[model samples]
Target: MPFLRENSGKFSPEKIGALIMVLFPLALLLIRALNGSFTPPTPFGAPPGLGAGPGLGAGPGLGGVDPALGARPLVEVIRFIGDWAIRLLLITLAVTPARRLFNWPKLLIARRTLGLGAALLVGIHFTFYLIDIGSLGMAAREIVLRIYLTIGFVALVIFAAMASTSWDGAVRRLGGERWKHLHALVYPATALGILHFFMQQKLDVTEPTLMAGLFVWLMGWRVMQRYGRGTGLANMLALAVAAGVLTALIEAGWYAVATGVDPTRVLAANLAFDYKISPAWWVAGSGAAVALASEIVLRLRPLPVRRAARA
Candidate 1:
């Protein structure tokens, strides 16, 4: 934290945010380790079935005798981290909108750090995936064979390029225009990442569906901003509501295609309070909350008063 507080540039709101971004994935890894996901006893890759050794039960560590070892799969941690990478990348994209929405100009400083943090997490996720598959060769083979992996790998490559050019020197060298063009790759990278998420999941695509919904909203907001129409609180709130509705429709469609479930049932489930809160509600709530906060803040800031002096 001391290092985090040290002067790098002008103090910006994103400074603290950048530090948190670094710590978040590390904390997740720590949690996974504490839950016994990292007690493999050996440095080698986990073979086909984890905890499948001759004497070991189907859990973490050798012989599965460690009390720390639970039934949770270590490979799931890879998915968790990968999901976080995608989320962080989305957050990075959201920074500009957030700054505009909240009138927090200093937030601009945090965007690059967030992008790089996402790239770093993605790199770690990919490393664990390679380890899980046993070797680089096998990983490469799988990527070639699997469309989802190919999509994810392409996104990673784009992130890598963006990360490499994130410095002042790169801006100076490439000129701002070219650099902006290159960084625009984040758009397609995000699409591919979301697609990869949808494809890789065998079941329970609620999370990916929410992510896609958020992505759609973010892009939609950008378009609105471009056309100079959606910068106000009311418009923003409307966008949020629309996005939530779109999220529900997307989820319903996916279930219809993948599971042969009645899309009407899925849509009706959004109206029902019989189940846990769905992602659509979460997305809508988040958007509305942000919009309300911005409205409140704008109202609270007092206008300068002019005094008339009496002779």
Candidate 2:
């Protein structure tokens, strides 16, 4: 009901919009379960079946998800659900920046719904993992023994905590400041989510790199705001540069530490225009576009008449 009702107990446009946002992905899952034509995109040149390994298969083990139906590859279906969880989580983080940039106070209503929806999807993602293994005890042991799984589990726990406390009564009990500080764990939770994603990749890491870059941009903006550098054009552009460089470093760093690749070569490959544009450039371009849009919005804002009396 919170997804459909505004804070004032009225059914407002923002609430309706948030409900739509929440349900759309579930519908996508249903479609994927019934018809596999709408499979989520894979990273880079990887085939759809690239990572279809163990614990993911077209069998009767899907805990009612019925990944066995349709052409939905079990691994891809699960990955699709998990990716949407991350997407929703990222969108939740983007809401505040977007509201501030566009001067849309109504946008705040969607944040709770978005965050909780993301939590729900993550719950489902984990549920599918359980189904894949077909045993809770085994899954528990795996989650305990596997570092990547542990990272994802911790992130899920954070999301669950935030979701449980999203109500007004909980906020009253915890106090607004304390509640906010508790929810601040989302940043690190998301970092863990990204790490889990990268570590699980058997092939291309293009999507994980891009998602991490976007997270970097969001955090950069938050840091700028904290330092009183307002999200002005110059500051935003500078943040974009920093985020891009950091993104490249992140990609190169992962390759260096996780694989036998040369970090310097990977980092330098980002500047190779002759090949594909790296995820770093995409993140920078996305950030620069947002900065330009904010600049335009500021300039186009209505000017106050000198003779106008104070309200």
Candidate 3:
């Protein structure tokens, strides 16, 4: 009670928003856990019906395939969670840069909560994936050996390590410089998560493309900050390099798909693309763009301050 009273002022609008952001994912997890047990509405924009399709529904007599064989409810839930987790991680990473550009101190409080929540979601995703793989009689070594799976595993490990040392006590123990260096691993973790998604999808790269765009924007802000204004030549060169790499990867992935090569077979096999656009993707893109824009506007506009009279 004393601690609560002492910290009552911390429950400001910004803090409340941060709390809501963290709770939203937790609510989704809870809904997923209770989905089949209580027949809840599809938790993660799962297209109206729960079981309806060739490889996603609960239809019986489909070549002796179990009704639940298509899209495991748990897997769908976990994927939805993973998607948000990555987005949240990106958002958390952007906060410091945003603060630097906008000169806002309030943004700092939200970062820790978002980072922790993202880590929790990633952990949930890993747990669900392992359980699903085990149920299919696949060995851990086999799962770990897959390119995308390995990437995802490494990303999750990095995220877990970062999350474990997120608190003030851990920061003090590790020292600020060491802590900062360790947390920078988040960038690579995010890239790996995006790669995992790109490899996991069977059809269309729309989602991955949008995610890449967001990451580009986030990283661009940092570059702009570091280089200062009017570094157009450097910016162009960086953009060209990024675009070239992305084009090559996209081409390679498409080639692999066309030839049935399955460069990331292990990771690809586990995914059942039911062929539907996820609303969450749009929502996330819109929200992030809006937030970034708002920060930009705030920076451009100055708040009025009262002046003391000389008389």
TM-score of each: 0.81, 0.85, 0.66
Candidate 2 lDDT for residue 189: 93
In candidate 2, which residue ranges exceed 4 Å CA deviation?
Answer: 1-11, 37-40, 44-72, 302-311
For residues 1-311, could you state the per-residue lDDT of candidate 1 as single tens digits?
12234355445556677869867888978887787664322212223233222221222221233345442354556666787898898999899887766666667777777888889989998887776677677678777876777888999899899999988899999999999999999999999988887765534666777798889788878888777774667888998898899889888988798779999998888876665567788778877887788778656742223210110
196-269: candidate 2 lDDT, tens digit per residue: 88876634677788899999999988887777787667888998899999999999988888777999999988
| Model 2, global lDDT | 0.78
Which order, best to worst by lDDT?
2, 1, 3
Candidate 3 lDDT, 132-233, residue by residue in tens: 555433535644556666788889889989999987898899999999999989888898888776665434444554566567656655665566532233
| Model 1 CA RMSD to the hidden true structure, in angstroms | 8.5
Predicted structure with the largest lDDT when compared to the true one: 2
Positional deviation of residue 292's Cα in model 1 after best superposition, in angstroms: 1.5
TM-score head-to-head 1 vs 2, winner: 2
